[model samples]
Target: MSRIVLITGGQRSGKSEQAEALALSLSAHPVYMATAHVWDDEFRKRVEKHQQRRGAQWTNIEEERWLSRHDMTGRVVLVDCITLWLTNFLTDGQTTEQILQDAKDEFDRLTAQDATFIFVTNEIGSGGVSENALQRRFTDLQGWMNQYVASRADEVILMVSGIAVKIK
Candidate 1:
């Protein structure tokens, strides 16, 4: 059987840190599956910072999309963030509904394997509503995706001010 853990928080709320700690506790050499797509030098540097934080015990895999292609059976896999993963699909020229359904389907396929999944995600919609239409749309998509993942997760943690509060 598979186990899912969802960690969510606002920006800079230590969601990744919590996920990393949980993954390390579960496995000595956990799989660090990053879903970020480096679009520029600044973003690349940010990715490097994250890479530097992890020790040599982690097996890193960078996949912008199609996470179901990776067979992570019997392993502990930590997916850094759902926001970036969703962003990758948002640009595919598909409607929001289509993209959401595809994301949910992909998530289902990936979690079907007998492994432990620790998912890190941002809670962007908790604040004030976005003024931009695109931001609003993305926020909605992200929120829905987060909810979907959380529903399937065996445990859910909400990070607030670098503190983890278990919600499920």
Candidate 2:
């Protein structure tokens, strides 16, 4: 069975760095799955910075919407983050159920592959309550998605201040 590792934390909490390190330890041919979409110049620069940081050792795949069901034999796949992926689905007029189903399908695909999966997500609920309806709805859906994925994960880690705390 493929090993699934879920890493989650606040922004700038070093989750991505840890995920990359774990992937390097697992396989030489690491696949970096980027799910972020550049909305503005600032965001584009941020994405570029991440890409530059990953360097040439990785086969970078930019997946903004639905994650592709690919065969990952002899590779370590790192999903840099899932929050942006969820936002893409949510903003694209997709229902929460649909988004979850899509993620479930992707998870099934990932699990079937002979690869070490490092899934990264953000801790969005920690920002307290949101007054906006869309924000609240998005947070709820993200929380649900995180719980569901973590349940299926072989290992779950919470990164805080660059420290990794294993929760499962």
- Which candidate wins on lDDT? 1
- The prediction achieving the highest TM-score against the true structure is 1
- Give the per-residue lDDT of model 2 (tens digit) for 104-138: 77767766787778999999999889999999888
Q: Count of backbone clashes for each model?
A: 0, 0
Output the TM-score of candidate 2. 0.93
In candidate 1, stretches whose alpha carbon ends up further than 4 angstroms from where it belongs are none
lDDT of 1 by residue, 16-99 (tens): 988999999999999999999899999999899999999999999999999989999999999988999999997879999999
Candidate-wise lDDT, in order: 0.95, 0.86
lDDT for residue 43 in candidate 1, whole number 0-100: 92
What does each candidate score in C-alpha RMSD? Answer: 0.7, 1.4
* Span of 10 residues, lowest total lDDT, candidate 1: 9-18
Model 2 residue 161 CA deviation (Å) reads: 0.5
